[model samples]
Each structure stands twice: as structure tokens, then as C-alpha cells.
Target: MRFLSLAGWLTVVVATAAPPSVELQLQDEAKQLVVRVEGQPAMAYQFGDEFALPHFWPLRSPSEKLLTVQRPDPYPHHRSLWIADKVQMGDGPVVDFYHSWKNLRRPSKPADGFRHFIRHQRFSEMKTEGATALIEIELQWIVDDNRPLLDEHRKLRLVALGNGAYFFDLTWNLQPHEGDVKFLSDGVHYAWPYVRMHPQFSGEQGGVLTNDEGRRGQAGTNDQTARWIDYSNTVAGETEGLALFVYPDDTPPQWLTREYGTFGPRRAEKWSGTKFTLRAGESLHGRVGVFVHRGDAKSGRVAEHYRQYVEDKL
Candidate 1:
């Protein structure tokens, strides 16, 4: 009897310490990939053709609170979390995939006569290992009707951290498929990947934005170069936040911060506001980490996580 009781107790302890299970579900009809932790959806990747481009929406905190807002008022083009920019293929007109709606013939019908768009071709890979899930997808930068300007390979990895926090790792590889492609995005209008927090988590609603340098709020942090940035707030008596970390690149990055609810790292000065060409067959690469955690930046150990991310520890 004593031995049996001891074994039962050990089983309970091991179960309590076990890491949460992560799962990836592909909903083809919905055109979305839902990532669930322990069977509950933590976030989703929306790639439906109904929109100007693909984006991630409803990024939820550990407490299941929505941390991001999609197409909010004033800036309806700002998808919750996404990447886009202006580009020109050969001598063709510059198409602003970042503000892609301009190429649509009808705002209500995105599939009608869109001239230029980013189309998700297929998912090359999707799998889960232990508490981590990964997705690899192929996409194309399309111009005219069916001409391909660039081929994009994107990978996303989600690691389930205990206590409901998580790490979202993103890597992008863009190769010019046709001729030389010129990136014509200006410094003031772009971010490699933007995060637009929900109104409840915006500075207007008592949230705080802080960078690695201890700069707080939009006025102090806007356009500043930082290794990481965090946004947090207390809502419904619970504190939670999100942080973004940019990997090292040739040109140090600048960021765009807003008090109303937007923040992201911009391309380096050498490329922003100037033409950077990727000759045919050449590729441009980028990587970033999105850390969603409980509590404020300090309490959440945003800096430590960022360091770990840089060292590939997480």
C-alpha cells in the first residue's frame, strides 16, 4: 500500500511539470492555420484571398485576452500583425503591397480585379514537436494577371512557454523571380513586421510602450533603434504584454512607434526611402521574434528573452 501511494504521488508531480502540448490545425476552407496550445487556440495565420495580403490576427495572451486588433479605425489597412512594402519589378509601376488595397477594382470584392497582390501558394510543411509547432509556406509576389515578381519562403515557429506565455519566431526569404525588383518603401511608412495592439492595450487606454533602452511611450521611442520593444497594460485586473525583437542585420534597424496602438522595426536606413535592388535570383532575408508574456516588460523578462532569442536559446 505504501509503495502504491508513493508511485501515485510521483505520477502527479511528473504530470504537473510536463510541458503543454502544441498543435497546428489547417482549416483549408477558412484559409487559416490555427495554432492551439493544450487544445486552445493561441493565435491564427489568416491567408484568405479575400484580403489584400496575409496577416496574423487575434494574438491572445496567456489569459486568452486579445493582444492585437485587426483593421482598426483610422487605419483600416493596418492588419493586426503583418509584413508588406512597396516594390517595382523591372520598369513596371511601383505597387504598394503594403497598402495593397489601392490595386483593387472593388473594395468589397478582393478577388475581382486585383492588379498586384501577395498570394499564398501552398504550405510546404506543418508539424509539431513536443511543445513547439512550425509552419513553412511558399508565396508569390504577383503583378499584372499571373506574372510572378518574387518568390517568398516564409517560416513560423511557435514555442509554448509555461504559464501561458509563448514565443513566435518568424523568418522570411524573398527572391526575385523575374527581373530585378526594387524596394521603394519610405522610412516613415513601413515596418518589417508591424504589431497593432488592441485599443484596451494601447497607450490611450493606459498601456505603456518601452524599448530595451528604457525609453517609454511613442514620443521617446519612435524612430529609435532598439534591440527589442514591449507594450503592456493592465486590463480587467490582469497584466499582460507583447514584445518584438529584431535580429542583427547589416544595417542597424530603426522603429516606428505610435501611442494609439502600433509599433514595429523598420528596414535599415540604407534601404528605407531609397531604392534597393535584388537582382534576379538574389534573395533578401529577415528574422524577428514576437514574445507574448504576462506582466510588464521588466517582470516579463523581455530583455532576457530577447538575449536568449539572439543566442537561439529559445
Candidate 2:
């Protein structure tokens, strides 16, 4: 009996000392890559060809509460979390990959009529190191079925933050595959990557929007520049939120925030409402961090995390 009790105690001790872990699972049939932290589903990357473009949906809070909404009304093009922009390849017609469906001949049948899209060609890497999972993928900005306009290399790293929270880092590198690719996005209608929160966590539903400089709400933060922004709220008696952080060197001159649940950093002033071009060998690169935590910005130490992000600590 004494020996059995000692063995039971050792088992409990080992379990308590175990570190958090992250896992990536490819669900081919679903055309999604599911990310799990400590064995719980946290988010998914949807890349089915049937989709107008690749996007991440069902981004959940630490407690597994859905924090994002896909295809919300008023602007169905606003995917939960995605990257998009308008571009013209060489002298070709301007392609609105942001409002991608507009480039489709038959909007309802995406697989049949997509004239321009950000296509996920393949996942080049998927591996776990310590408590973090890394994913690297190849994508193409294609036009007219098979004409590739840009080649993209996307990298994502997810780290398991203890107590149910997590940190995600994303990098995008785009190189013109053909001739010059001109970015012709408007200042008002775009984000480097947008996050649309679930209705329950929207500002209209009691969520709070905060920026690094201490601004709050759409009126205060919209069209304003910031190093980082956070949206948080208490839903079902639990407080949780997510923060988007821009790299110090790549901080956009302005950000777009909406009380209806949409928020993100816009491109720099030089590129907004104007044209920026990348030559055939030139690449446009950007990086951002997402911190999903179990409390509001204050309690979640959003500022601290942002600092770590800039210092390569987070």
C-alpha cells in the first residue's frame, strides 16, 4: 500500500510539472488546418478552393469561446481574420482580391468562376518545437484561372501561453511573379489583415476597443495610428480578448477600427489611396502578432506582451 501511494503521488507531480503544448492537424477533407493548444481546438485556417480566398475563421478565446465571426452582414467580404488588397498585374485589369467575389463570374460558384484569388498552393512546413507549432505555406496570387501574378510565402507560429492563452505570429512575403504588381488599395476599405469579432463580443455588445496609446472605441481609435490594438469583453460571465500588434518598424500610419466588431492596421500612408509597385524580383513583406488572452487588455498585460513582441521575447 505504501509503494502504491508513492507511485500515485509521483504521477500527480509529473502531470503538474508538464509544460503546455501546441499541435497542428491537417484536415484534408475539410480543407482546413486546425490548431490545438493543450489538445483543445483554438483556431483553423480555411483554404478550400471553393472559398473566395484563404482566411482564418472561428478564432476562439482561451476558454474555447468563439471570438470571431465569418461573413457577417453589411460587409460579407469581411472574413473573420484575413489578408487582402487590390492589385493590378502589369497592364492587366485591376483585381480586387479584397472584395474577391466581385472578380468572380458566378459568385455563388466560387470553384467555377474565380477570376482572381489568393490561392494556397501547399504547406511547405508543419512542425512543433518545444511548446510552439510552426507552419509555412506557399500561395499564389492568381488571375484568369492559371496566370500567377504573385508568389507568396506565409509563415505562422503559434506558442502556447499558459493558463489557456496563446500567442500567434504571422508573416507574409509577396513577390511579383510576372512583371510589376501594383497595389491600388483605398485608404478606407482595407486592413493588412482584419479581425471581425463575434456579435457577443462586439463593442455594441459591451466589448472594449483599446489602443497602445490609451485610446478607446471606434471614435477614438479609428483612422489613428497605433503600435497595437485590443478588443475585449465579458461574455457568459467570462472575460477574454485578443490583441493585434504591429511590428515596430512596420507600424502602419493608421489603423481601422469599427464598433461593429471589425478592426486592424491599415497599410502605411504612402501606399493608401495611391499606387505602390513591387518589381518582378522585389518582395513586399509584413509581420503581425496576435495575443489571445483570458482577460481584458489591462489584466491581460497587453502592453507588456507588445513590448516582448517588439523585443523578440514573446
Candidate 3:
């Protein structure tokens, strides 16, 4: 069994060597995940993990404890969970559903049929060099249906920097998914207390889309493509991160952008305000980057990091 424990550094001392990835250990008292960046010297807690958005999204029932933090928000964004146990499967320990409240796809019961395991989830990632550290992570997911099972794959990656911040990166690429494309939802959430208290330093913005029904065959509503997301934050650390997307094949209306944070993001007349469709022999992909650094939202130095990521990928 695979278990993901507190994957973070202990002290807040920056390192003096090359950078390497590490894990963060959440300090309940501080109510913040401590990070140690190797190259960044002027920033502590330069980047933080998922600051939960409480009021908007449900604490996800039994999935609360497994989550890191939860606050309230207006609409769209809702809540976020730093998923370390759910998808890890046999990599560490089995999910507890309570204290270790993990979110995963339980075997299908005869009566229920199938459903989406959880909406969108965020996870933490840390990289360090001696005392220095970098904190980064990525949160993503897609609707998983239980109709004969076609094909699917999703991955989350994080990079810790030199100061005491983090950068979490996630990649979600779904292929040959079987089923009718539906609507999508996306919005914003306030980490309520933390964000409300430090509004000038950190927050988030989101966007999503769904597909149509008529086009729900092997060539659903949209086609293959991607986009760019620059993270300008109100926090410490000047070097932020870069994110993008890539869809190699399919149709249009570019369905699948999440506009709301709900169990449903499809083309139905229910919660979501969108719809989409897809079929076999199709592929879709996206990339997003979050740069962790020191400063306010207006002066956040994320452009430089975006350039760095572009060059590194090339």
C-alpha cells in the first residue's frame, strides 16, 4: 500500500546549494506549510500549499479530514483538497475515508452504477537544496464514467524552490474516454480567513468549459488544443511558474473548461451552464504553471518564471 505523509521540510532555513525537490510538513500552529528554498534567500513561506475555500464548496463530506485547509468563498472556485492519498493507490497506505479521509473511486456497487469520484483537487510539491527549498503543486481531474471503461490518465507534479515556498504543477490528459460530453463549471473561492486576512498577498482565478451532446460520438464536441496561464500572486518569492495546455486531436466550442466547482460540469440542464461531447480515437491535454514568490499581486514577478519554463521545455 502507498501512503503520502507530510511531504515537506522541517525548518524554514534557506539552503546554499543547488535546488532539489522535497516534501512539506504542515505546522498546525502556524496554519501554514513551511518551505525551504535553496536559491531564494529573502522569502519564507514564499509559496503556500492549497488554502482551502470553505463556504462555496462542501467540505466534501467524509473527505474533509484528508483535506489540508478549508475556507469560504463567493462562487465558482469553491473548495480544494491537497490530494496525497486518493490516487496514490498502492504506492503508500490505503485511504482511511475518515481521519485519513481520502477521495477515490470506490468499487461500483450494483445499485449506484457510476459517478465522478471528486471534483477538482489540488496537491502540494516541494523541492529543496540543503536548507533552501521550493514549494509547488498542481490540481486537476476529469469526469470518470463506468461504461465499459475506455482509456484515461492524469498526473500531478510539484517543484519546491530556494526560499521557503512551493510550486505545484499538474497535468491532466484524458484519451478515448467513452460517454456523452456534458457541461462544465469553474469559479473562485476565498481561503476565507487566511485569504481574507492576507488578501493582498495570495488568491486564485479559474476558468473551465464543457461539450455538447449531438457530437458525443468518437469525435465529441471539441478538438485537440491547449492554453497559457500566468500566475501573478500576492506573496513572497519573485520567481513564479508557467502553465499551458495541449490537445492533439478532436472537434470545437473547445468544450471541457470548468466554469463551476461541482460534481457535474457537463452539457446537462442542471448545475453547470455548459455542455460538451467526445468519442473514441480522440485525445486532449492541458498544461498550467504556478510561480511561487515574494511580493504583492500587482508587483508579483511571475513573467520571468514563465520565460524560464518555456526555455526549459524547449
Candidate 4:
């Protein structure tokens, strides 16, 4: 092969030096951490002193379409993207961190005992670059008396995957601060690492839900186990959607899906008297992959992206 001449090489280099299509820019505010892409608002991590638990709200696509919902009238406790569940504190009483937000003021039953809180402690590390942003944060699951029941180290990574798509990865390391802790389900649904889709993407709005097991619709896919689930909708004459992927492991997680647009993997249910135990000083780690694409599942090639994610290609 003949090598390029000096003049030709210089021309090639200059032509290839275009700016990146997307850039991950972060703005740290007093109450929220806002992330922008190409100078456009992408999403915000709401961990202010007023929030009961941290959440990512108003996640937007590269086309600037909102993908998540928060504090809808029907479900006041359903934040956009969050990790939460009813928990048991070893020998102590059971607590409901998922619904016990002080700002929520959800009526509580005395028999329900004291509600708990998940407070954002601090950010341990954060880094952002041309197309990716990674953040590590510490959180405390505490009771009314300020007794910390569990400590959580959560790592979130976001990457601009070109073609109006995005990749989001979440890793959680949880350990009991005082004693053993158990994630107890509410029996009706398991609520952990959840995403509430926007109202415009609801099934009533002509949205479609598909899973790896070839299941479709919210009824057949609910409480089912699948490697990935996609919820797609047509908005303004364009098809776009979000997908959830459960990494390959010995035991795949049982997922919770809804037509109203809430989905996530859940811990075992209380009706089954099941609990995921985390011993003191021992951390329980879990990981998941999320893809936000510009088209429906098939059109977006969600399976292919999921394969790349599993292989760590992206």
C-alpha cells in the first residue's frame, strides 16, 4: 500500500477533526445536578435538602423530548428514575423508604410504624468528558431518629451514543451500616431502580411494550423475567423509546412492568415472605443497563445495543 503524501495526510487530519456530536456538560446547583448535552438540558439529579430521596427527573432524548415523569397527580410518590423499596432493619422494625418522603406527606398508619428516609450524603467522585459522565455518590437510609440503617454507594454513568441515542448504566453497592438489612417488597409490586415514563408514552397513547421473552403488552409482561424490556411510543410523527437491560448473571431479576409506564427489577415480595439480605459490613452489588433510543425497539436495534452493553463495547 502506498502511504499518503504529507499534503494529503494533513488534509485528511484536518477533515477528520470535527467536533463531537454530543458533549456531556454538568452544572452543579444547590438543589440539583443538571446535565446538558450540546448545551441543551438533558436531565437533572434532584438531591436537594427538600427531597426525601434522590431522583433523576425530566430525562430528555437527544431530540429534546422528555422521557421521564415526576410527581404525577395520580401517583404522587412515583418519581421519574429512582431506587427505592420497603426495607427491614435487622432486629429493628420495618420501614418504608419508598413512600415516606417528608415533602410527600403521605398519610401513614400508626400500625405501619416509623417511616424511614434515604438521604443523600455526598458525592465521592464525578467526571465528565466529550460523550460520557460518571458520578459516584453516597447515601444513607435512615430512620426518624437519624439512625442510619444502610449505606449505599451508587455509580451512574451516561454516554451519548450518537444517532440520537444514549446509554445509561447504574451500579449499586449496598451495605448495612448498623446491622443486617433486608429489602422487603410490598407484595403488590417490587420497586427498585424504577423509571416512570412520561404520560405521552403511556399505553393509552399508542405505546408498545416488548421484552426479550417475546412478550408484549403490560398484562403479559408484568412480573415476568426478561433480559430486557422496551417501551416505545410515537410522538410528533417520530418513534422513540427507552429500554431496560438486566445484565447476564446466575439469577436474572424478576421485573415489574406497568402499562401506566413504570418498570424495574424488584426484590422478592413480602407476601412470599422473601427478603434480600445484606449483612453488616458486606455489600450487595447490582448492575443494570438503560438505552434511550430515537426509534422503536426493533428500529433502534435495542437487542444489538444490549449485546454491545453486555460485551462492554459501549
Candidate 5:
């Protein structure tokens, strides 16, 4: 009989073990939704009023390593994962919802430029079954003493994909509570979904970024178009990262990736000096995918994942 080393036996056991199970725990009073994989805390959804919008922070990979930085300095607006933008109601002046949280202290701003807040109205749905968890919420975008501008419905589904990976599908719908609203941006950045990776995963720290279009790094990737982009780095002696995917069914959102470890989609340049409307009584929809895995782009099978996403195989 052949005798295997202890380490070898352990490795085999780990490899052959059943995939990790995922559990989502909702802490309503704490205003957080926690996701656990194989009994290890994996991520959290934050919907508290501490920020201007709802976001996910402290995202982690299968290695239990944090993959996102929560409210980094100099850019506290850069949440782990969020959506917001400068917007206007009908012909009204632009309201800086994206960065308005900074102006919370200055209570005397003009009504036209008043800071806005996204208040979590309620959790419409929260359920966990098998290897997936689903969350849905309703939010009110308000300004100037509870003046509502928009109503948003956000839904997220997290699935355990095994192999040190998890997948999340997100859908957001916005409707003008008053009248038509426009999402506008003056610069190269706009209101959209984004992620801020942990400093350990910054491109300056030996991390790698790749897009479906074959572009590498933030130098030539920012504001570029791609179906998806992957940002990978090593942590705790293991390689892992996150990838953002833009579903073909939704509007083609441009990449707002960075080398310092931020990834997002922007409509600013796409709507520079112009704006699109979320008509009254009509909802504008946005869909996206987030993949957390344990490897670099190729090693993580990024393309295969994208194909699965577009083909609805996931």
C-alpha cells in the first residue's frame, strides 16, 4: 500500500469536498445583509443613510480576503459598489447626488443644487435557497426637505458557483416620482455602478486588469467600451479578484476602470453635455453582473464566464 503525506491527503480532501454553501443573513436593524459561504462571511450589502446611496462594501473572495475598500480617503465617494449620478428633474437644475454626501454639513445650499439622499424605503424581498440568495429593495431619492425626485427598485441575486467563485446579478430600475428626470454629467465621469477594490489589489501593487476587448491596464482602458473587465490581484498568498460584466440587453455602459483599483461603468462621457430621460411613469432599467473568483483574468476563465453571462448559461 502506498502512504500519502498528511498535506497531500488534506489537499485531496479539500479538492474533493462538496462546494461551499452560501447563506445570506439580513440584519434589518443593522441595515446590512451578510452573505456567508461555507459558514465564512463573504460580503455585505449596506443600505444605511450614512451615504447618499445604497452600496455593497467589504466584499470578499472565497479565500475570505477582502476584495473591496470601504470608503477610501480622498475619494470617500468611491464606495465598494454603488450607483448614482448628477441628475435633474424635468428642466430643473442639476442635483449632485453622486457627491452630495459631502455637502451634508452645509445645510444652506440653494434648492437647485441642494444635496440629495437615497433613503432605503424597505426591503421588498429577501430570500435564500440552496446555493443562491436574492435581495430586493425600494429606495426614494430625495432632496430639499423630503422632496422626492425618483423611485428606484434594486434587486440582487448572489449564487455560489463553487471553485472559489461567486456570481451576482444586479438589476436597477428608476422612475421619476415627479416628472421626467435626466441623468447628466459634465466631465468624463457620470452616474453609474462602480467598485473600489482594496488597496492590496491596486494595479500599482502588482495587480492586473484586462477587458474583453483585449486592453490591459487603466492607461488605455478607462472610458473604453467592453462587455466586461477583470481586475485581479494576489492576497494572503493566493490570487483572486473581481470582474464586472455589462449585460448586452442593457445600455452599453462605458468602462470607468482605474489602475488604483476601481472599476465601474460611466455614462458621463456618453452623455457629456447631453442627457437621457427616465420618462414620467416609465422606468429605466439597468442590469449588470459581478463575479468574484480566485485567479487572474485568464486563469479565472473570464471569457468563459462572459460567454455564459451573455448566453444566459449562468
Candidate 6:
């Protein structure tokens, strides 16, 4: 007689399970989002056992626009990619995300070091206790390191987005705000269709973010004390991509300088721009949400959808 134990039968099925065809993402209204960008592929998030920063380190040079640079083995960005089940794949499009100084070719002071300059070399293991995927990031930062940057810790939660959009709930134990943190989108506009700040239309109308107190005719307090800004191009049907930042403790900061397609201090060579500092032993945190959509940031319909997202308290 031929018989099979239930456990053995289950193991057989598991071993023969089909490989994942495409990556997946969605939104979780429950948790506050820390990071979420539209249209990122699974290949973009590969790492070793823990999340490792690949050597590439999504970079942009002076002669060229923003692009992925492949240094030799120990590729920087490759180390950053999260590891899957050893699935080989081709390199995907370049998506620039700066959680540390690595993202910038030249940040403020380039040598003086950044505000509260946190030294982050490792990512906590991806742990799943209940229904959420949790990952904590440790940084080697020095408070009193700069006038505006105070040291702090950061935590991010990757929740399942049954749909095609991902919800990254990031909590920042921030280093105080050194210089103002915003975007320099002149050349960058070529890549991302929509880009804008919160309390402002997404990037569709081409509206830029400036610390123009004069424009605050009737706006609320800059709310510098830990608030968020969201940008997205949408995932499900069609929408706008998002760019937003929040500062807890209302960390004081200065405005950023402009570059062709880049945003940071000392773009060319002459340290030109405001320089804020984060005192030692201080902490701050914020959240950012990105949604890749199929439309512009200011379309009438898109505006309504954005309102819905805000109304839903996302």
C-alpha cells in the first residue's frame, strides 16, 4: 500500500511552488507612512540576509543627469537591495532615495560632514511578528555635530499593499534640522513628471517650494514640528507621484540652494546656501509617503484623489 504523511505531502507542494512573477505593493491607512514610491521593482530592493546597501549608491554626476553608478564589486546600491530567495534578475530603472549622505554626490560641507551626521552602516533584520513587516535602521550620527542636525534613530515598516502601491511607514528619531530639507527640481523634472511639497499641489503645476514667508498670506504655521508632505504618481489606476517630509519638534532649519537637477549643499564648489545645525543629544522624526500614479500632480481629478488621501488621513 502506498501512503504519504500529511507533512511530507505539504513539503512536496511547497518545494514545487511557482516563483513570484511580479512584485507587489499597496497602502495601509492604519499606520503612518514613512516611505513609499510608485513603480519600484522587487529587483530594486534586494539585499543579503539583512537589507544590504549595494555599492552603486544611486548617484548623479556633474556632466550627466541623475543615474545609477556601478563602482566595482561591493556595489554600494547592490548592498542596499534587500535579498529575496536568490532570484536572479536584471538591473531595473534608477530610483534615487537619500536616507543618508550616500545619496548625494556632494552634500553640505562635503567634508565638514552633514548635520547631526548619523553613521548608519547596518539595517535591522526584517521581522514579522503579526501582520506587519518591521525594519529598524541604526545610524552613526553625532549630535552637536552641527548647528542644525541633532542625532537620532529611524524606523520603517513595510506593510503589504495588496494593490500595486506600497506603504512605507517611517518614523524618524531625527537629528535636528540643520538646513531646510526640500528638493531642487529643475533638471529632475525630466525624470519625475509630478513633484511638489505638501500644502502645495503635487509637482504637476510646476510649483516650486520656497521658504517665502511672504507667500504665507493665510497658511498655517509651517508646522515645522514633525509634519509630513506626500507626493505620488499613483499605483492602482492613475495618479501623481509624491515627495513629502515631516519634522518633529519643529526642528529649525534654513532654505536649500538650487541645482540643475540636484538638491543639497555645495552643488558646484563655493559652499553657497543656508547651513542649519542639529545640536548634540537632540532627536527628531518625520514621515514621507510616495505613490506612483498615472497622471499629473494637479489635474482636477488628481487633486480630488489627493484630497481623498488626505481626508482618509493617509
* Candidate 1: residue 209 Cα off by (Å): 0.8
- The C-alpha stretches of model 1 lying farther than 4 A from their native spots are 1-15, 107-113
Residues 1-314, candidate 3, lDDT per residue (tens digit)?
23344556443444454445454454555434443233222212311223211111111111111111233243212233222111111122222211111223343432342232322233344444443344443322222332222233334344554444444443444443444322122212111011111122122322111121222211232231222222222123232222222222222112232212211111112222332333455544433443444432223434445445556531
Q: lDDT tens string, model 6, 72-170? A: 222232221111011001232121332333434346544543332324445664454332456665543233332322233556554433333333444
Model 2's alpha-carbon lDDT is: 0.88
Q: Between prediction 1 and prediction 4, which has the larger lDDT?
A: 1
Encode model 1's per-residue lDDT on 7-40: one tens digit a residue. Answer: 4555222323567789888899999999987677
lDDT of 5 by residue, 72-163 (tens): 86587778888777778866656877776544646464333335678789989988887888989898888764888999999998888886
| Candidate 4 lDDT tens digits, 206-306 | 88889887788888788777788998899888889989887786455677788888888754232222656767788767678888888888988999998
For model 5, the local distance difference test gives 0.79
TM-score for candidate 6, residues paired by index: 0.37
103-182: candidate 2 lDDT, tens digit per residue: 88776866676777889999999999878999999999888888998999999999998877999999999999979999
Better of 1 and 5 by TM-score: 1
Give the root-mean-square deviation of each candidate in angstroms.
2.8, 3.1, 15.6, 4.7, 5.3, 15.7
At residue 310, candidate 4 shows an lDDT of: 89
The lowest-lDDT stretch of 10 consecutive residues in candidate 1 is 7-16
Residue 20 miss distance in model 3 (angstroms)? 5.3
TM-score of 2: 0.93
lDDT (CA) for every model shown?
0.87, 0.88, 0.29, 0.76, 0.79, 0.29
